[model samples]
Target chain A: MGEHETPADEPPTDEARAEAPVQHGCPVTDSRGQTVLHPTREQYVDVVKALADEGYGMCVDLVGVDYLLHPNRPVADGVTPERFEVVVNLLDIYNRRRIRLRVQVPEHDAVLPTLFDVHPGTEAMEREVFDMFGLSFDAHPDLTRILMPEDWDGHPLRKDYEVGAIPVQFKGAPS
Target chain B: MTVSDPLVRPGYVATGEGGQEMRPRSEVTSAELLREVGAVLRLSEADAAALADSDPDVVGEIDPDLDDQTMIINMGPQHPSTHGVLRLMLELQGETVLRCKPIIGYLHTGMEKTGETLTYMQGGTNVTRMDYASPLNNELVFSMATEKLLGIDGDIPERAQWMRMLLSEMNRMSSHLLFMATNGMDLGAVSMMIYGWREREEVLRFFQKVTGLRMNHNFVRPGGLAADLPPGWRDDVLRILEMLPPRLEEYDTLMTGQPIWRERLQGVGVITPAEALALGATGPILRSTGVEWDLRRGEPYLHYEDVEFDIVVGSYGDAFDRYAIRLAEIRESMRIVHQILDKMPSGDYRIQDKKITPPPRARIDESMEALIHHFKIFTEGFKVPEGEVYVAIESPRGEIGCYLASDGSAVPYRMHIRAPSFVNVQCLPHMMRGGLVADAVAVISSIDPVLGEVDR
Candidate 1:
């Protein structure tokens, strides 16, 4: 749905209709309170749009998380489902403030919508996430290994990723 | 004539176990050192250094000698330009650096990804090790982001804020002192290396006194400090305040007035304001280019709005300007430090919010809930109500920012750092593009990159 159209039948929030994204819901309190969690995919989109309207035009970085051993979402419950989360770090040089969008997605077939259409900086950070955590950004411009070589298997940074297993070498580390 | 003829006729000495030469050795220029090294390594004869104009590591388009064309010179992984194990491929003709490509990640530690597994409080411990030199700045910025996310930024105590400001300026001074020391070494001022490091050691002593650790002091938490300043922190800091200025003046006289230092720095590694901005430069590099945009001034967090200090700027934006601006900043930082010490207010140092800061250690033994709270906080860590926030502070190098994502859990959802050295590094090639290859060292020194920040 276009920004203004709002799904044709649903009424938009009061501030959305006002167009003053900067004054975003004075002391911006949602029914969700201070900590907006689990963001139910649609809530994620609304938050991003509202923030964009608030002047954070740049999504500076994005990284994924694996809650393989989270105490709250303990793995004793058989493979922590929906334990994966993505953090989108946004910056607005114009406004001089920043925000972090924590969007959660499940571990199995973990994927999230790519905001590459809006920010270019996400390109590098997302590819890095894909390389390390195997989480996919649906439409990232160019998803490929950045720091690691093409033949290298397993992201070195992942919690489950093995280290010292791959005796590393560089431009020319001879056997 | 044979190249060994010069070696035979004069007091030309070879390096050895001849009792490791005393440093601040009024040795030859690094170029001359490299030429001698090339001879020692048997890679080239002594005359080959004089005959050759470009780095031997490159060939064809990579070498200027191949076509009388632009040559690519690899400046690091060993060269002095990169402060640590960083490499830059420079395209050069004669002494002019044409196209410089900085190849980093030689020291990548995976700190950000490592941070994901750590709890919110432990996260500061992990991130603080990145810059190594300015540990408080890293922790302070990261803690601020968590505070904003948890909606408790204002709950931090007044004394904690002032202490953070105090230690932060001290960190800035020592960090800039290191820069001065190293920049002088890069410029062939032998004594400056000694002078700068000597001053830095004293600052480290102060850091150890207050935070209990020399480099990685996870002392600045979101709501307050890691621990209150140690007893006598006041007296020790006062001593440092007394010691630094005269030494700085000593450096000013020893090398700042020397024609060789001026010649090496004045017109070298010139970064214009437009290019610095285009590349997202920060700290000394950006200020040298005349931006006058410091987060301390622009946003003014931690009662900075109340403090009176000047944002030092330089006119030329070259290696000299980068040096002079930082030197001036150190003096200004000292001024701020003195003010923080004199004006500090007495109160509880940590935040009162029970959810963030645990009850007193004494109370932990008496109250079961307090004991459990302290244990849980120290062991598993606290939750941050699923949300995200970014907090940036002006580090010695530039803008050191932390973007934190919390999922109302024990550990962070994701943490990404916007390191100043990483951004400031982009302008290296631009600054070096039209400069002589010889001046490349001057430019690199001016940027004062710490690969710990870059590779992290």
Candidate 2:
């Protein structure tokens, strides 16, 4: 089993996984020594739940990345690139480890399952994502505009959103 | 009408979907109550159910008159005790706070949006404004993330790392000192505020001397620092170290021993360890729960591994514990600063890479190529390799992290600051849930949230 093992007699999984590592049914890639798992939109919550069960208890950060221009950005194999990516950094404090989950969301649908059921701390972070990226979270307790006014229009963090283009009315003279 | 049109339409209400206004108690459903209670307590399903059954009065479901008893009120967007523009919608029944929701974003200036427009060389200035209390920490995280993406994180000079540690520790002392002042002021010990500020000013004086600005110094940059330490910096640092110990002892006498101060904070705004962790609270708040997790010790970013210091923790996760933790943390930071003073290396302050670091000011005067390099670096900025990195360091408040995504451009494709205050502020409702309305100020002070960091 050790020295003269043929391809047929050998385990097919270990060598195959060495070429492309997968974790929690998602393609895992190492980005600068950090473990990054690329899970599809459908598998996002399940993978997060699985990781949480395995002791990635604290959800440290949740942010959205808009790839409107850089649509061809490199992702791990077997993962489809999408217009928007939600990055969640989970910390396993007991193990002193961190894992990042990058789930791709299409431009049209722009919705993902909420992490509130798992990590209640993400309530505000998810609201910020929804406020800044225009991506809605399904079943979020209060998915309101957090860092923007409740009445404000357009998500500001999207790549397509222009900067320094909002027109303002002068209070004193114009009226 | 096109959404991207620049013109403002007359009589258009914009159709924003959500609001922060608290609904009346009668309108709130049992499901919503369960969710709110579960969130505020961070309790598991069984515990939440158990609580509902045991204390129907607290859940407000059994008594129909409870709807009329509790009234929702706005605490602040401008209240003096709120720290900044943090508005809390509290449902109060007489003096007891029933449910609370923090309404933030009053200070949101779209700094992350601005980060995308700013080049890598100019990114420091944008991030430093977020956590104004510990601007150096914000700059340090941003610089570290940028350096990591540039594939030069390990090549940073020993002197630069020590210098960064020095400034970072000094900033922590000053920030905690400010917290001492504010925490005292919030809890009604007015004189302690003056003493706290006076000591903090001593630390800021050193910062101003080294960085040329007090707050929002952007001194720590990607390659290393904006400049080398000013002449006689060691003596200045020693002076801060010399001045702090006794002043801190005085604070211990002024506020720590006072019975009134103890009454205000002890057993008030209490949170369990699981709730604190589940809420993703870090730094003093998490430490106050006796979880000995400090990123400086756990992750060992920069040269923290070489330094010897103890992580200050508290047994009870109450306001008193949070206050005591911060006070003790000031001493721990000073200890770290002393270690840095002894271990501070002598060499170049920034990295010597020609591509990332601009030509020295002296070189730009003599050679045309040096002048062009300097101009190009300041104007176009250096391009970073395509990658994304999340760099978190223990800031004065909590874990201030920078998540930078590079598209191999001079400007970051998407720059996001995982601000600690933004996450820590979420604990306010959980902390204030069953406390008196007056204790809310003490709760807010214990958290020590800087709104710029939260709203950014």
**CA lDDT, every model vs. true structure:** 0.69, 0.87
- Per-residue alpha-carbon lDDT of candidate 1 for residues A1-175, written as tens digits (9 for 90 to 100): 2333232122225554334322222112121222222344445556565666656654544657665555254111122236676766555555565555556577666777766445433544666677668787775544565445544566665556654445654434664
lDDT of 2 at B393: 97
Error of 1 at B58 (Å): 23
DockQ of each: 0.09, 0.60
lDDT of residue B300 for candidate 2: 94
Q: Best candidate, TM-score-wise?
A: 2
True contacts kept of each: 0.08, 0.76
lDDT of 2 by residue, B129-230 (tens): 999999999999999999999989999999999999999998999999999998888888989889889999988888899899988898999999989999
Q: Evaluated against the true chain A, what TM-score does chain A of model 1 have? A: 0.64
> Where is model 1 chain A poorest over a 10-residue stretch in terms of lDDT?
A26-35
Per-model TM-score (chain A alone): 0.64, 0.85
Q: Write the per-residue lDDT of candidate 1 for residues B95-172, one digit (tens) a residue.
A: 775455566566877787778788887888898988887888999899888888788887788898998899899999
